[model samples]
Target: MIDQELTKIKSSTVLVTGGAGFIGSNLCENLLNNNISVVCLDNFSTGKLKNIQPFLNNSKFTLIEGDIRNLEDCHKACENVDYVLHEAALGSVPRSINDPITTNDVNVSGFLNMLVAARDAKVKRFVYAASSSTYGDHEALPKVEDVIGKPLSPYAITKYVNELYADIFQKTYGLDTIGLRYFNVFGKRQDPDGAYAAVIPLFVKQFLNHESPIINGDGSYSRDFTYIDNVIQMNILAITTTNEAALNTVYNVAYGDRTTLLELATLLKKHLVSLDESIANIEIKHRENRAGDIPHSLASIGKAKKLLKYNPQFNISDGIKEAVNWYSKNL
Candidate 1:
């Protein structure tokens, strides 16, 4: 999603939780590029130092080694901040299925702590990462903003709860908040080693190593794999949008294009091979479908288009090409 022209706001100090994660790190870099001050809070659980290593010397960026689960840590991070981008979360459906309690602790309790801390700090706005999984169990062809279904997993529940809590916080405490329901975000700095690593990075790394990438289920499951730049645009718009009509709402942040996993791997391999022809022989393995995974996820960004003036610049092919180039140089 893109916001054409944003009003220059009064806030300079910004806090980004989970700032070392893939999307968070990109957002931090983009903000720094715009000459904005940033306070990054992270626990290094799933996030890594390498993601934000390039910014260690930037005077505009500050890193706080803290966990959002602790209110004290959240409070510390919120101080002197005008906006809070809450990206900290224990993501991954299978990971949550394996350990729902930890997921709940981080995604639910941790989110609440951030909200409370931001409210207490009198932050100008609080924009947090919501997920397209909130549309869970709904088999709609293209997910709209208003309609949603029951959360299918602990991760989904946690994200949906963020929206709920944001709404109540807005009503009860008068905190301005916005939620961006991200749909299958993937791009640069995305970790490829974790057990719950996203498909693109995992497949990219696997193919790079000349290893067979695994595809779950039949070759038909598709997703709206959004680019990191689009997500950065959404965050910038959400934080800067002063339109009363745009406040206190969740917008689907995606490219509105879907690609099946099988197709994705083939495309990735094509790109990787173009870079390093030796990897062209990399094969793909199919396995049983994962539990708690939606068969297809497609988002209708009409709401964002109409309300936030959102316009996505890259479709899946364009995004994948950029992502593959990043991985080629970095991973």
Candidate 2:
């Protein structure tokens, strides 16, 4: 079904901003694999050159080394594009907290630039990478789309603002938009050597090196750790779904299951030890919880399933296994 939908748009071009980043690069690869034309725009601030190096030689792949903060760059990438997958942003809550101004400048101002570029280019759809952090202090067990609380961090505010702007763009300018609220996504190509690196990849790399993995706050914090493939499916569905009800709305792109930090470390160790038995002796440490960290995060993927026919193929365990294998070979 995904292939059939993509086949319909094979003749069309997709402009993926931040295409050198983890999720963006994966999207670019999947689109190119499907014989779809892809234009990748990246500034390499957080996105690495190695991530998209494989696609550099592909005839269907076009790389625009530029920043989205500049509207001209956005315009250049959107030229002749049929659809837009806006993945460019300064991710990480701690990074945003340290420098809210830069985060807002790139996430909010840059997002607006892409919206205008896509609108002016007359693209069929504008799908963007929203964040589950938008759930904020809502304290809901299963986060639904409509009910959201005050944003807990600067990153959350920027993501929620993206949704608001997308709604206004659709209502006022007649541009179709879809916002995908991604949960704790992790997989191959994800950077594990950074201060703002995600937990799964960070832990995987630590285990591989025989270093102790740290668990914050007694390891009770849980997340709906979705895999990259599931996120890719959500993006494809957002752009290709024929259902009118699915258009101009936000959907949670997650696995619909939660795993605590302790559980996650245990699982990673279990998977990694299979490759190297000595890793089993690596101890897990604990520390105080970080500020603005949510106690638990689990998404209600019912809207995505009902509207976009999203069927997530990998759960946390399966995703961890694949990610562990990749990190073992790559790291």
> At residue 321, what lDDT does model 1 achieve?
94
What lDDT tens digits, residue by residue, belong to model 2 across residues 65-161?
Answer: 9999999999999999999999999999999999999999999999999999999999999999999999899997899999988888999999999
Clashing pairs in 2: none
For candidate 2, the lDDT comes to 0.93
Candidate 1 C-alpha lDDT tens digits along 1-331: 2323333642387899999998899988888877788999999998999999999999999999999999999999999999998899998999999999999999999999999999999999999999999999999889998999988999999999999999999999999999999999998999988789899999998988888998998879999999998888888888887688999989999999899999999999888888889888777899999989899999999988887777888898999999999988988
lDDT score of residue 59 within candidate 1: 92
**Candidate 1 residue pairs in backbone clash:** none
**Which candidate tops lDDT?**
2
Every candidate's CA RMSD = 1.5, 0.7
Identify the runs in model 1 with alpha carbons over 4 angstroms from their true place. 1-7
- TM-score of each candidate? 0.97, 0.99
